[model samples]
Target: MATLSEIETWLHDRLPALLAEYEVPGAAVGVSFGGEVIDHAAGVLSKATGVEATADSVFQIGSITKVWTTTLVMQLVDEGKVELDAPLRDYLTEFVLADDAAAAEITVRQLLSHTSGFEGDIFNETGKGDDAVEKYLATLAEVTQLFPPGEMFSYNNAAFTVLGRLIEVLRDKPFDACLREYLFTPLGLKHAATDPYEAILHRAAVGHIRPTPEAEPVPAPVWALNRSMAAAGAMLAMQPRDLLAFAQLHLDSGKAADGTQVLSAASVEAMQEPQVKVPALGLMGDSWGLGWELFDWAGTKVIGHDGGTIGQGAFLRVVPEHGLAVTLLTNGGDLIDLYRTVVGHVVKELAGLELPALPTPPAAPVQVEVDRFLGTYSCEVADVTIRQDEDGKVWLDQTPKGIFAELGAKPEPVELVGRDEQSLIALKPENGFHSPHVFLGDDGTGRALYIHSGRAMRRAPA
Candidate 1:
């Protein structure tokens, strides 16, 4: 491992040039190692404003807020106010989904670990009122089950939003207030913002997005998503330093900097214990804990999570064995690559670790039958179709819908290459990396049930 001075020096020398090389609008990076924290920033916050980014500039942490939401829920466990494995309906009686039986059986742990099995990508705008999360719960009544409760692993945004509602009921406050009271104040985080209303007070970095895949990124039309899904990571912005402070709390096992016991030590240990093994998706963890993504780097247990929203991306990686954690927040431009470079550099330098190898198209491949995967899979954001052309080349056609369309998402096609009997890798990179689409389960008919690209997109009935 490198000395903190050596790593800090390397960051000061390389961050600016790397931003230019990657065409990123701006970025903030922070590291917590050996009980100390250090951070650096570079580039313009917005090309439209031409404001330079500072180390204290706040950027949206996106879905990384899940870890925060998880913390709030775990606090309830510490107080004996909630049971982890108890059915969610016991707490929120109004909780109902398309499958009443599955809804009745869903437990608090299922939502925490994302094994509740219902469709999770539904990001309904339930209004900006305090009832947003409560109303959002009502919206899930129509959401279909992707699988039975506790059946398998799926990345679930709705699950956390539902958990957010649970927090509101348990704490007698709105989700934002719970965050501010339970986390921000407890940890003494000064730079953290829960919503756009508060984010405006800081030197906040706006997200950037490319209207078309071929163009340079521009300031996104909006700064954050609707507040209804805030608990599911719609709006939470903070400087890299404040973010590291939160990570430090976990390293100290729920103890804050002032030696305050904000979270219980048992809950902290439970959150890092593996709960479910995810599909063999290279982009995420091999398995998920209560809220954290558990990464197996060679044989070491690395805990972390990644978040993306409105062209902004945030990454948090923690090597608990070395008492280390690192985070990178970026507005736009090849974020996956930048994260790989920046956090990858941090992990390698501070912990003597390397990022896991992601799958890519094989150089030489034998074509296989594609008829089994030839169908349309539907989700809230997009409708993806798997089809083969007359030339016998299989490709995925993705057409944006709902919220994705509102953000100007476009339809595009990417060739698919055989990875194995049950999985395929995109022949071309979209955004910054290729998606390894894994097909699994039975849809009651003899076809592929779900096509998982991070989130499980269930196939529409034939």
Candidate 2:
């Protein structure tokens, strides 16, 4: 295992590489191991002012807030105030869906596991009243279901919004307040508030967006979603060390820094158990827990989650077996792959184990007949024309530039890393896609049909 000093040096050296490569403003990292935290910060917090990053600089954690929501729900379960499998409508009368029957069958557990089959990003609150949650729930009569309940994992943000509403109803308080009282305060997370924008204005790191390859950066607006959406992505600014404290609590069997048992051991374990299968997300061997993702990293089990805001990214990974937790908070749009890389490197060095690399697609042959795969495959989302290049190498012609970059070069006998009937995986480097690309096609031409947002694509004709 790497020494603490060595790990710190590696972080200092590698973070600049990521910043230079991605052009992000700055990043803060915190790692907890053996009951202590090693916190580090580097680069500029605001590129405009050249303000150096610090460990206390609060960063928006985006969807990493889901863990707090899940923890609150599990706490309610511990108190017998809520049942995981009980229909959510039982607690919130306003809960309903476009499909009345399916909505009635949706359970609390399904929302946390993202298996309610609710459409992702279906609820639009633009121009709505301040009470967006109430307005949206009232409009559920018009909302539609993407799939049936428990059918598969769909990563529905709306479902989590409903979960936040459920929390408000059961607690008789705003969802944010419930999170603060039951989760944040009890855990001694003083620097980890849901609304750090107002709480720590001077020290808060404002999100910035770089519009073009060569353009001035602009401050991104802070999102003001209704508390109903809190479960999906509401929590705000947090210092890296503060986040490490939260991780340590979980590592210490849900005991807070002051040694108070904020959450029962059973509840923590329940949050780590895989409740649903998410094969579509390259997680065939993994499962979605209450609020965490459970997967095998090397031979060790990893329970963690990733988060993204409109212009920021955050990731929290915890290895229970090794009592190690890593948190990365960045104020930029495309830092997820960097977060994963940092985590993998730190874990490898600290635990003396190598993490698994992402699967690579098979290589294309230098020479081969290209007529069998020649066709203009069209899908509902994209049109892909597979043609033979001048070098006789088959390539996916007419592919969107964004999608093509994600797919990389064409390959023969493309391996399916992930698939469903509607989509297929082509080739994705271990780092993952810069922008989401959807795969649309069959196994004959290629499992992937087209490249849409969040999926991979490849050329099949040559």
The top-ranked prediction according to lDDT is 1
lDDT (10s digit) by residue, model 2, range 58-144: 787877787777888888898899999999888887887778898899999988888886555543442333355555666566666
Model 1: per-residue Cα lDDT over 91-147, one tens digit each = 999998999999999999999999999988887988989999998888888889988
Residue 244 shift from truth in candidate 1, angstroms: 0.8
Q: Each candidate: what lDDT?
A: 0.89, 0.66
Candidate 1 backbone overlaps, count? 0
Q: What's the distance in Å from true for residue 341, model 1?
A: 0.9
RMSD of each: 1.1, 6.5
After superposition, the stretches of candidate 2 with alpha carbons farther than 4 Å from their true spots are: 126-132, 196-202, 213-218, 221-228, 280-285, 359-361, 365-462
